[model samples]
Each structure stands twice: as C-alpha cells, then as structure tokens.
Target: MQVSGTFLAFAVLSLLTIGGAVFMISFTRVVHMVISLGVTFLSIAGLFVLLEAEFVAISQILVYSGAISILMLFGIMLTKHDAKDEGVSKANKGWLSILVVAVFFVIAFWGIQSTPWVAPPDNAAAVQEDNATQLGVEIFTRFVIPFELTSVLLLVALVGAIILAKKEEDNE
Candidate 1:
C-alpha cells in the first residue's frame, strides 16, 4: 500500500487536535488553556477543510477559534480566579483524571466497535456537492428563528458577563 499526502495531512491535523486538547486540559493557567482550545478549534477546522467542507471550515474558524475564544478570554480577564491551595495533591488529581479518561476511552472504543457501519447512499456524492448552499438555505428557511435566538442568547451572555465584572469592580 502507498502512503497518500491526504492521509499524512489528516494524521498531522489529528495529532495537533489531540495535542491541543491535552495541553488545554493540562495547563494550569486559564489563558493558556483558552489558547490551547483555540489551537484545537483551528485543528478541527483544518480537518473540515480536508474533508472538502471549506465553508464549514471557515465558519468553524470564525465562530470557534475567533469569537468563542475571545469571549472566553474576556470572561477570564473579567473574573477573579484567585488560586486557593486545597487538600488534593496535583499528582493524585492527575492520576484520577487519567483513570477516568482511560475508562471513558475504553467505553467509547467499545461503542464504536460494536456499532454496525453503513455505507453511504448512491446520491451521497450529489448531496455533498452543494452541502454549504443547502445548509444555508435550510438554516434561513426552516431554522431562522432558532439561529437568531442563538445569537441573542450569546449577546445576553456577553452582557451578563460584563455586568458581573462591573459589579465585582464596584465591590472592590
């Protein structure tokens, strides 16, 4: 069997995505974690692009890597997260986390392996050609209210965060 460039690209992106997630979880600083999350988001967007979904990839980058990350950074900056030294040792917490992750991984692997995989339908290629256009049409026609409501909810959250931060500043 011959190795393909696409496979190599996918492997690199997958590693980056997993590495980012691991770093995000391992980092102690909130800002560092958020940056790692952005890396992970970008890697996911790369995966989307590799799958030929350029529009989805761009949206992923814009929404997750850009907006959501900035939102998280703003939230972190606005809040006071004073470190409180607790009873749990870092090593113990690390071991517990590892064990929990291992169990979850095992369960996920089992579930995926046990499931019956189905082949794509004959028209799958035809549908793939205009997925982005179809998605936009569906969202605007059928899901416009929900889409707009989501934007409203995000605005509300941003305002709430600002208000809470202001209240804290006043208290201080």
Candidate 2:
C-alpha cells in the first residue's frame, strides 16, 4: 500500500527500457537504432543493479552497452545496405507491425495477470550477497568451455567483419 524509492526507481528504469526499445524499433536509420539499443541495454543494466545483481549489471553495461553497440556500429559502417525498397510499402509495413505488437502485448498482459505472485524469502539478501561468487564458480567449473567458445566466436566475427571491410575497400 506504500510506494517505496526502490519501486519508483524500478518504474523509471522500466519505462526507460521500454521507451528505448520502442525507439529502436521505430527508428529508420541504423545508427539511431543502435543508439536506442544502447540506451535499452543501459536501462536493463540499471534494472539489474536495482535487483542487487551488481556483477551482472556491470557485465551488461560492458558487454551490451559498450562492446556490442560499438561492434554493431562498426559492422554497419563497414557493410553496404544501399539497396532500394522492393517490397511492401511503409504504410502496410507499419500497420502489420502494429498488429503484431498488439497481439504480443495482449498475450503478455494476460500471462502477467494470470500468474500468482509471491513474496521473496527473508534469506534472499543472504543469497544475493554470494551471487557473484556463485556465478563465477559456475562459469569456471561448469560453463567454462561454452564461455571460451563464445569469446572465440566473437573473435571470429570481428575478423570476418574486418575481412569484408577490406574487400570492400579493395573493390572501391
């Protein structure tokens, strides 16, 4: 029955996250969309911090807001997407997107309303305090191979992008 500062922070962060996503989807330019995506990523990081997951929040900022956004910008700058439109008109595309979004919203709203909410346990704070340690242990012990593989995959993608850009430069 009372409004807490944490709840207010959450409301603000959630609105920013949703607004950024909407802007990202609505933008026509690739650069604008990427910037909006960065904003969304940062807001989500804020939400994670609000939930007391500092390590995850920092990882989100560093990985998503910093590295991924920069990578996307580089990829966009390197690639040529100058092809003219040859498909549906903007008006039809807009209407179709609106319909799809409306359906998704309805489904999400129904799911949220139907779910039974429960309060957190008193020891949740104790569990959260060790989350970063637990996460590190799990990653190193159980998910180390997958984590290393993901890093390698990112390296490969970066190399591929550079090769493509070099090819484009050579052609030009």
Candidate 3:
C-alpha cells in the first residue's frame, strides 16, 4: 500500500515537472516563465526525495529554486522591460509543434518503459552506504577542477548578461 502510494506520488510529480518545463519554454512572459521554472525545480526536488536522495533533494531546492530562479528573475528585471506588454507576435506553428512534441514524447515514453534495470549485487551496494559523505569527498577531490570551471562559467555568463543589458551613452 505504501509502495503504491509512493509510486503514484512520483508519477504525479514527474508529470508536473514536465508540464512546468513546457510552460517555462512556451510562455512569452519572462516572469511567468521563471515561475514555471521554479515549479519544475521544486518538482525535481520532490522526485529526488522519492528516490531517497535526501541530500540531493535539499541541494536541488536550495540551489535551483533559491538561487538560479532568483537570478533569472533579476535578469528579467534588469532588462528594462519588467512590465507586461503585448509585444509583436512571433510565428506560431502550433500544429507542427504539437506533432513534433507528441512524437518525441511517445518515443521517450516507449524507450523508458522498455528498458530493463538491474540492481547492483549486495556487496557492491556498500558503495552507497554513506552516499552524502562519499559524494562530498568526490566533489571536492576528484571533481574539484570541473566544479571550479562550472563556477567560472556561471560568473562569465553573469558578466555577459550585464554587459549586454547596459545602455550605451550617446557621444555628443
């Protein structure tokens, strides 16, 4: 009974996550898109919880929902178009989009359902016994360079956005 309930919860969250992602990408309003992205991040955190990855779940909520979403919202505000405006209509190929998305979803669902998953042997499972500690050690030791590089990349992106959004002064 409990297992079924958990399974149902996971399924619902998964759908919510996908829906949120679609809303984020499809909506023209930047604020609405950011809110939808928040929903997606929160749903992903819930999924991590359902998978028993408590540390990862907490980090997902903290980093993505807390930091990344706020950063995106700030970026939108900095762009000088914070107020909602019915801007020029772009090309809307609704039927083509629908067909493409439907085909992609069908193929993805079929692949996921058809795949066979096997659990590791009992002895090998010991590798996960202290997952949080092991994960921390690996991140700091083995993956430290990549982690630092990602931080640098984020910083560069922030600077680029700021430069792009700045207004040029007219020289008399």
Candidate 4:
C-alpha cells in the first residue's frame, strides 16, 4: 500500500496520543499528569484538523488545551499535595481492572468491525469552503444557551476550588 503524508501524520499523532495517555496514568505528580493530558488533547485536536473539522479542532484546542488544562493545573496548585503522599495510591483490584479493560476492548473491537466506512469522493474540488462559518452560525443561534452554560459551569468549578482551598485560621 502506498503511504500518504496524512497517514504518516495520523500514525505519529496516534502514537503520541496513546503514549501521553499511558504516561498520564503512570505519573505520580498531578502537574505531570495534567501536562500529559494536554498532550493527548493536542493530538486529538490535530486529528480533528486532519479530518477537516476545523471548528471541532479549534474548539478542542480552546476547551481542552486552553481552559480545562489551565483549570486542572490551577486546581493542582491550590491543593496541598505532598511528594511524600505520592506512594499512597496502589492497585488494589487487579482482577476487576483486567475484566473492565477486557470488556471495553471487546466492545471497541466489535464496533470497529461492524461499522461501514464510506470512501471519500475522488473530486476534492466538490467540497465546500463555508463549513466552519455555518458551524459558527449554528452554534451561536441554536446552541448559544448551552455554550453560555458551559462558561457558567467553569466559573462554578473555579469558585468551588477556591472554597476548597481556603484554610482555617491558625491559633498561635
């Protein structure tokens, strides 16, 4: 099979994304985990761009990479996390973990095999250029309330974090 530039890029990004997720789970530090999560989000965003979903790509970058990542980092900084507390986590349910992973693997494999994928049109010139514009307009008109609610949700989370981070007065 002839290898294409898009296929090569997709393969590299897929490896980076999987590696990031694995490293994120393996990291002991909360900050390292958040950064690794950002890597996975970034690679997914690149995948969206590759699929020609520009609006989704930009939204992924803004929401996942820009906002969610910063929020996580801020939350980590606010919490009293000690390096000595890192080893507190241990794998307690070995069989359950394996069972859950096996179930998900079977479901994903079945889904992939069952799905019918259509090949793209050979005439690339037939594609329209106003997809992003149409998506933006629809979002503003139809999904404006949900979009605003998401902002409100983020604000509420920030406030909750601040409340959690507040310390009691110390008696000397």
Clashes per candidate (backbone, < 3 Å): 0, 0, 0, 0
Q: Where in model 2 is the C-alpha error above 4 Å?
A: 79-90, 155-172
In order, what lDDT does every prediction score?
A: 0.87, 0.87, 0.86, 0.85
TM-score of each predicted structure versus truth? 0.77, 0.76, 0.71, 0.74
Displacement of residue 167 (Cα, Å) in model 1 is 3.2
Task: Point out the worst 10-residue segment of candidate 1 by lDDT.
Answer: 79-88
TM-score (C-alpha, index-matched) for candidate 2: 0.76
* Residues 16-127, model 1: lDDT tens digits: 9999998886777778888899999999999998988889999999999999999887777667564322334787897898799899999999999999999888987677
Off by over 4 Å in 4: 81-92, 119-128, 141-172
CA shift of 88, model 4, Å: 8.5
| Model 3 agreement with the true structure over 1-172: per-residue lDDT tens digits | 2568888998899999999998877787889988999999999999998876778999999999999999888878877566454543444666667788899999999999999978868887567666689889999999999999999999999999888777778747
Clashing pairs in 1: none
Best by TM-score: 1
Q: What is the lDDT of residue 136 in candidate 1?
A: 93
Which parts of model 1 are misplaced by more than 4 Å?
78-95, 168-172
Residue 136 error, candidate 1, Å? 1.2
Model 1 residue 19 distance off true place after TM-score fit, in angstroms: 1.2
Residues 1-172, model 2: lDDT tens digits: 9999999999999999999998876777778888899989999999999988899999999999999999888878767453222334687887898899899999999999999999888987777777789889989999999999999998998899778657464454
Clashes, model 2 = 0
Output the TM-score of candidate 4.
Answer: 0.74
